[model samples]
Target chain A: MHDTTDQHLFERVLQDNDQLADENRHHFDDMGAYVVNFMSAPGAGKTTLILELAKRLKDKLSVSVIEGDMVGDLDAERLRTAGVSAFQISTGRSCHLDAAMIARLLHATPHPEGQMIIIENVGNLVCPAEFPLGEHLRIVLLSVTEGDDKPIKYPVIFHNCDAVVLTKTDLIDHVDFNFETVEKTVKALNPKVELFKVSTKNGDGLDEFLAWLEARHSITLTASAV
Target chain B: MHEAAVALAILKRAVAAAEASAQKEEKAYAETAENTAPIFDVVKIVVQVGEFRNIDAESLEFTFSALRKEFPRTQNTELELINIKAIALCSLQNHQFHPEPANYFSCTICGGGIQNLISGKELDIVNIEIEQCLTETAA
Candidate 1:
């Protein structure tokens, strides 16, 4: 008799990844470090934003960066040049970096005192939104050149991100970037999201953006102290 | 575009999981006389995604179909998509509602529609159908 028994695995496929992500979160928690997952589209200024954040928060806190990319450590090298401890995870075939990759990366590196994990996820708003990667906070970048309708079209990233940074604002007037429409659209997607309009080129609005990190770092530090 | 990334993940995980299953089955059948390890044929894959997940199931399928050719384990596999609509709960009013995604919706009872997102964030592989190699010997 021919037999046919189909396997029913109601298992959540992303569950394994999420479990690994939770483990990563636990590692950071024990270290009293806050993990920030930075996500965005290509050329949206995420690397530049991260570099700026590193420079501003240099003396105040020790920052460790984990860079995820299709194949290149250019961003990691840039961060290293700036005196930041940067690690790169190259995903040859994978488009996005999963929690297991992070687990392996951190295992090979030593944990420094009072260090924060700044993870620059593979630059794609869609896939990165699904993987948590054990981040305490999620920041998505939006460059002025990219259309204002991105928030509505790619609502998942906007909705899930803890904050939105409108990058390259200095070039706002040069491009057809409508500031009001994007802000309204972002708020429509995530009502309570904290938004910052910044430009790393001319150094406009960097202080406020850096202050936001300062506030978050202090809050985490306070909680860990208690 | 995002589907390209997702499709790669789906095929990779499916292969990885099937390999583990094959190993386990081989070890369990070691005591039997016909101790041939099962070679799996992945016939179908079911992916469950939320409306708010911002993934196009059609696009994912296209991408998966294109990329499946590279994987020997899943070249002829079929894809099934389960779409989940986004839902919100008005805990203050004890009411739940399904709001249109990307819209600023308020709870009907409390006037605060964006109270909380209860569902529609799921992006998971819910099921996989693999035909196991079970050649029965004559008893």
Candidate 2:
């Protein structure tokens, strides 16, 4: 018997996942769909926000959703009931939705007729940040009821996301949440992260959020056309 | 837990690497000696886990230990995890500081935001130690 310690270096353990995500990006580009991966803690109102956005964008552009949950099709059922096209992926034991899951869904349903495809990732801050599902943009929801220190607590998710939607703003007055703290911490983690104060119930900042999404979707459409 | 998934990936990579090294050694030995069976045993796998990754070392180790018994090559393998500290560069003061656990957004000195993270957030399989055994097979 001979013992040998081979000097090998694999830079990232998630290299295979990243490669699959890149392939998914190419696929999304071919379909001319602007993909957004939504991540947040549980009960962050991801479904409600998507439904609101879909209702507003229905006349202008088509919107589709891919809902991911640990077990059940509850969110997908809600979206479908609201007259939006939604697909459900039950992850079973997985905390986060990996690129392979998305690839499998896409393979089964080759094309979705939405100019925008929003993937509502399994609700978790830490694990979801580690996996990228070929998304052109990543949005994280932080409700006012969840405390302002969440950005500090889960810095990676906030740092990696393209936008931070401060949800449940209508209840901001009732809660002890401080907006400035979240803004400062989120900016500290991500300098260029777009911050939005949104309340799906009151529709306070929904237009601004919709505008931002539409602008990005238009850019994706233009880029795909070229 | 996500650590379970990560542990599985680590084990798969380690076993694959051990088998690859064994195959190469077997090919080289076949030229010199015929009718010999080569067995590869994974001894140790070194993984680097960054502080920012939110991975629990004990959980990862436990999951890896539980799963390694499934693979004969890795049945007796030892998993070594090296923790890498997170260091971020403050944009305002240009200073580097260890971003405390769960408070990685702000700088320690200036309390300003970080321009970019200098280190941490690393998850990699650095190296593996393999033991190769050769025994003559009955022809």
Name the top DockQ candidate. Answer: 2
Question: What's the TM-score of each model vs. the native?
Answer: 0.80, 0.94
lDDT of each residue in B61-105, candidate 2, tens digit only:
999999999998999899999999888888789889876634546
Per-model chain A TM: 0.93, 0.97
Task: Name the regions of candidate 2 deviating beyond 4 angstroms.
Answer: A223-226, B32-34, B101-104, B134-139
At residue A113, candidate 2 shows an lDDT of: 52
Worst lDDT run of 10 residues, candidate 2 chain B, spans B130-139
Residue range with the least summed lDDT across 10 consecutive positions in model 2 chain A:
A106-115
Query: What TM-score does candidate 1 get on C-alpha atoms?
Result: 0.80
lDDT of 1 by residue, B1-139 (tens): 5578678878887787667666776766667777655666677888888887768878888899999898866878888898888787753574677655334344545544344677887777778777664543323
Q: DockQ each candidate and list the results.
A: 0.35, 0.64
Question: lDDT at A20 for candidate 1?
Answer: 92
